[model samples]
Target: MAETDPKSVQDLTNVVQTLLQQMQDKFQTMSDQIIGRNILTEHSLNNDNAVLKRLKEHQKNPKRVKVHREVYLKRNMKSFTLKRFPQ
Candidate 1:
């Protein structure tokens, strides 16, 4: 059995970290392009639907909707709203 030197181990760790960062950047770029293309296509399609077009336009230029009454939340409580935005 051979013992690994500390410098060699550190170099290997650095290489692995660099490779991981490169992979993450590539994946993020690809995902962004895909999402952008989908949004453009969807907006083009919804141009014909008057109601959908109106909603999209509103989202593009968001106006404040009426604010509802405030509700109290308990400590350590997590809340989330699931909304499907028109593409």
Candidate 2:
């Protein structure tokens, strides 16, 4: 059997180590990106849930109603003019 040179064997070992390190670094970066996306999605879901809850609570109450100020002013002005003219 032909014996392998010590220098060639050492070079092969170094190449394999470098490749492994590169793979590990890529895997860590992918994992961190996925985790960051998951965290952002979770926060978005939480905000949506809070907004829905507040809307539901607002719907359940009869007195806590919203009216546009412009519409209210127009309506009052009409009523005032009608009362003043009496027609």
Candidate 3:
């Protein structure tokens, strides 16, 4: 029932951009953490079910991962070549 003015739209856009940037920064930090790797690796070692899922999620989508993801993707992909293709 309410219409947004140009200023309101601009403000909303700025807020969304700011939030996206902050989310990306946080994701970068989390991805860079030893804990994240440790958890994934630990899960990997303990659970065969998770390996393909994680590898597929990381490898099938190039835009979602960091540059270093290639290393892990290859390492995991080697185990399940049929599960996914490289992006």
Cα RMSD (Å) per model? 14.6, 12.8, 18.6
lDDT of 1 by residue, 1-87 (tens): 134333687877987888899999999999999999999989977775877766676676554221111232322122432233333
Work out the TM-score per prediction.
0.47, 0.63, 0.33
Q: Which runs of model 2 end up more than 4 angstroms from their true locations? A: 1-7, 62-87
Question: In candidate 1, how many Å is residue 30 off?
Answer: 0.3
The backbone clash count of each candidate, in order, is 0, 0, 0
Judge candidate 2 at residue 31 and give its lDDT.
100
In model 3, state the lDDT of residue 69.
Answer: 74
- Go through the candidates in order and give each one's C-alpha lDDT: 0.65, 0.83, 0.77
Model 3 segments more than 4 A misplaced: 1-7, 35-87
TM-score for predicted model 3 compared with the true structure: 0.33
Task: Give the local distance difference test score of model 3.
Answer: 0.77
lDDT of 3 by residue, 1-87 (tens): 135433677878987888899999999898789687898998887787676777788788766677667877888878677566544
Query: Model 1: residues >4 Å from true position, as ranges?
Result: 1-7, 48-87
Clashes of 1: 0
